[model samples]
Target chain A: MENIILTSSPTTPYFPEVSFDIDKGICEIRGESYMEETYKFYLPLINWIKDYIKLIKKPLVLDIKLIYLNTSSTKCVLDILEILKDYEDDSGQVKVNWYYDKSDPDMIDEVEDFEAESGIKIELKEF
Target chain B: MTSKTILSYKGPFYIELISVFGTNIRNFNDTYSNARKKLFKIFIELSQNVSNYSENFHMVNNVQRIGVGELFLKELDTAYCFTTINQVKRTDAEILAERCEIVNASDQMKLRELKREQRLNSPGEKFGARIGLIQAVMLSKNQLEYKVENINENFSYFSLTVKIDKY
Candidate 1:
């Protein structure tokens, strides 16, 4: 399977920096996302994950470092999480680690919400 | 070129000025961060709604279609109050009112659960209207209040206020 790489730009509405390493099966989505067309921007990322699950079948690690995302972007993030959850349910090795600033309690609460909503265990790491 | 009439229509813009002034806070840096993020998010959502659904203008960049709106942030003694003002068609106002009622009625826990379920089941592109508002409230840890004033026969001015307590 080919590796998928996308660099996020701040000029756009949803400015998220993405670094997905297909070789190591490690993907990181960071920065702020408040795009006018959120789902359109996230579709490729979701499709990549789905394709990876079918082909690579490796342990997938997701590092989330989003300091701020709008409600629309949050929904898209959840969609991405749901796909990962499905992979885990099929017994594919997957671990999601959410990194947030220690001083940012809002980010922590958001991660917790994602955990409760998706029923996927996410490791919260404070930096 | 009389100065008096030139500034007489300082209607909604005045409210916008007030909202901008309220954003200045002395303490609680964390609260400021959260409020600023939420304010930007709200601005995008509300402005898009005006652009997409408003019947008066079909073209995306038409100046008339752009909703007249302003956001104000006030640092109260113990809390920060954020307010937004915009003009909406009467029909849009009704729909907005219904959505606000539903969001205000739900508890925080319930709203979070709803947001999660909606995210999973909802098609990625077609995000429902009220969900964004509900999620914003939940994320900000604040309560929202709205008032509708009849303008002409077919339009009304809608003002929304959200308050976040400083901890």
Candidate 2:
């Protein structure tokens, strides 16, 4: 599968920078995410992940370092995590790491919520 | 709470304008830095609610879809209040009221649960408003106060308010 790479901006509809390498099995989602058309932006990344798990079956590392994400974007993130969780449950080599602002308690809670909802072990790294 | 209006605007909430508003709010009152992020988050949630779900929208140069609404930020001694108003269909008003009830009745933990439930309901906004409502309340840590002003037989103005207490 081709890698998905997109850069974010200092503007509205803050689409996060994404780099999903199918070969390397390293997917990193960074920056802010708050756009009106959230599904359109995330569906491909979600699909890329699914296809990787189904086809590649390599060691997958998903790095998420988003600073600000709206509720809609949050749902899409959870969906991505759920897909990874499934792959991990099946004894696939998968790891999820979330880097966050240590000073921002809200984001910490958000990362925890992602863990609780998806039943995934998201390693939290302080930024 | 004794508060005065720190910022106010009324017009079509295009994405560009929303970006400017966010920057201004982030730098609104540096003394309230603790509340800036929460304020910014709640503001984005509420304003996006207007830009996305307001029943009434117009075209910009026949190229862009613009949702018209009003936003106001009030600064008090202990908290900051944000209010938004937009036109909506009567049917939407009913749904908004129901969603508000769900958000208002829930505590922080329950609100978080509700948010997750609603989020899983749809990846395409079948329950988008529900998620946004729950999130605004959760981030603000305040009640979702609302009022419906009747405009005509089929439309009404939906006003929503949330307060972010200063830390």
Who wins the lDDT comparison? Answer: 2
Runs of candidate 1 with Cα error greater than 4 angstroms are A8-13, B1-68, B128-130
Q: State the lDDT of candidate 1 residue by residue for B34-134, as single tens digits.
A: 55555445544544443334344433354323334555556566555656666778988898888788778889878877766666676667453236677
User: How far off is residue B101 in model 2, in Å?
Assistant: 2.2
**Model 2 chain B, poorest ten-residue lDDT window?**
B121-130
Instruction: Give the top-scoring candidate (TM-score).
Output: 2
lDDT of 2 by residue, B105-134 (tens): 989989878876776666453334247778
Please give each candidate's TM-score.
0.76, 0.92
DockQ of each: 0.33, 0.48
- Quote the lDDT for B128 in model 1: 32
**Cα deviation of A59 in candidate 1 (Å)?**
1.8
How good is the docking of model 1, by CAPRI class? acceptable
Interface RMSD of each: 5.3, 2.4
